[model samples]
Target: MIEFKNVSKTFTAKEGTVHAVKDVNLTIPDGKIYGIVGYSGAGKSTIIRMLNGLEFPTTGSVTINGSEISSLKGKELREQRLKIGMVFQHFNLLWSRTVLENIEFPLEIAKVAKEERRQKAQKLVALVGLEGRENAYPSELSGGQKQRVGIARALANDPEILLSDEATSALDPQTTDEVLDLLIDINKKLNLTVVVITHEMHVIRKICDHVAVLDAGKIVEQGPVLDVFKNPQQAITKRFVNQETSSASLDDTTVVVSELLEKYPNGLIVRLTFHGDQAKLPIVSEMLRQFPDVDLSIIEGNIHQTQEGALGSLYIQLLSEHHDSLQGALEYFNTMRVETEVIKREQ
Candidate 1:
């Protein structure tokens, strides 16, 4: 397991001192896909740097397994680094090197035999679905292929932990999903603990088992992926969750709601939130069947599948001449363990 104990970092530059990270405490379990999410300059890079021993913390300590990373030096630090592989945002491959050669670079630096490294690189090329592109150079590959090479290179040393730093920020939406799916494949096949740092929340929803939300140099929120998505507490976290919960913006949601209100002025806009197996249950159909006197219309709804489980958000307008039926439907949702919120009641 990796533990960050009261960790904080500061920089003494021309502008005096700046606290980059403030008292971050986190524990990442072994073999779990963990994500650290934040906007630009939220101390994410600092934490990654500290993980690889690139920078020492000003206070507290970072420990992985049994080693104190901040105190390691020279040979100790170098050896510890070999156990952690890092995939960069940019491909960061040697422009002159072929895909096979790039994958062999790490082993070459460690002074492994040329024949042995080449053999390992060939297997990795196939593992990352770059079998035909092994001889191709960085320039010859697409953005996604280049990242595949980067991932293959990171695994050259067969590290137990893989760190990805904005690895898909440059790719298009489809390519991003492809890359994320590849990472998930790698995680399951190797049982490697994966750490992904990015500003995008959909990335977390797609791959991470657990997530930590950073804002203004502190971890304002964190938990299992499903729990966080099901109930985001902080404003920063809600902003992130909204990115996956629905495609519509708040303004768009409001506009649709306004139109719904105009049509069904006495309707109650009920928002239903459920997680995991609740998505498969026949709660909605049952509600409709039981409440035959009421009218139910779906406004907007989506079920997002996370690495941990599934989370769904559904907005339905309930209308009836009598208010009792609307209230009865709300009570039925409560018994089904669905979180319900009345978005608007125009009675």
Candidate 2:
């Protein structure tokens, strides 16, 4: 387990002092994938460095498995570092060493026998799906292959904890997914405590069980991955959650309203969301039947598969002569545990 108690860090420069990290308190459970998400300059990198004693905190304490990391120094700190391994945004491979030789470097430092290091390195090469490339130099391999070599080298000492600092940022989308799957496999097989730092939301949704959102050197919101994505609290958290790559922006509800008004000129437009067990598609049909005078049309929506269950959003327009019955129908959905928000009305 890893615990950060009121941890803060500051850097003094010629111009002024920079507060890189605020008073962060977090508890990372053992044998689970934890994610730290933030944009550049959010101090996420500083937090990861503190895990392995690369950077010391200005105040507060960092404890891992009952040992205080800030208190250790010299050979004691170096000895402790062997039990924790880290990977970076870049592959960071030694150009002079072959894949097998690079994997053997850490074992040599730990005083493992020469024959044992070779055998162990060979096994790891097979584990990372690089059995045939063991003799290749770093320059001869692709980006994904080089990262695999880094993974093998980090596991050479059998560290219980693994820290990944934007490990997939340099790879393409397809390559990123492949690397993420490999990390998931490693975590399951070795039960390694993996902490990943990245700004990509897909990374969190893909493999992380728990997550923390950092902004301006402080965690604004955090919890289980599914829960945080479903109900993000802070403005920074909401911005990350609602981000999209499409040409249209969904941040403004007016876009939805304008589209509805352009298509259905004389109807009631409402936004419907379902959480937990109330996310059944039959609710749409049921609402239409209950209010026979009302005509409903689904405009724009999508169903997201969350860890809890299927949650969905629907932009619906109701066409009817009686508006009072339509209003009651909205309340009916509310009583049935489905959520409704009125976007626009056309009388």
Cα TM-score per model: 0.95, 0.87
Error of 2 at 180 (Å): 1.0
The lDDT, on a scale of 0 to 1, for candidate 1 is 0.91
Clashes of each: 0, 0
Model 2 lDDT, residue 206, Cα: 75
Q: What is the lDDT for 279 in model 1?
A: 83
Put down candidate 2 lDDT per residue, 73-125, tens digits, no spaces: 99999888889888878988889999999999889888999999999999999
User: Per-residue lDDT for 207-306 in model 1, tens only?
Assistant: 9999999987899999998888888899999888887788677668778888888877788998899888888898988998889988888888888888
Please state the error at residue 267 of candidate 1 in Å.
Answer: 3.1
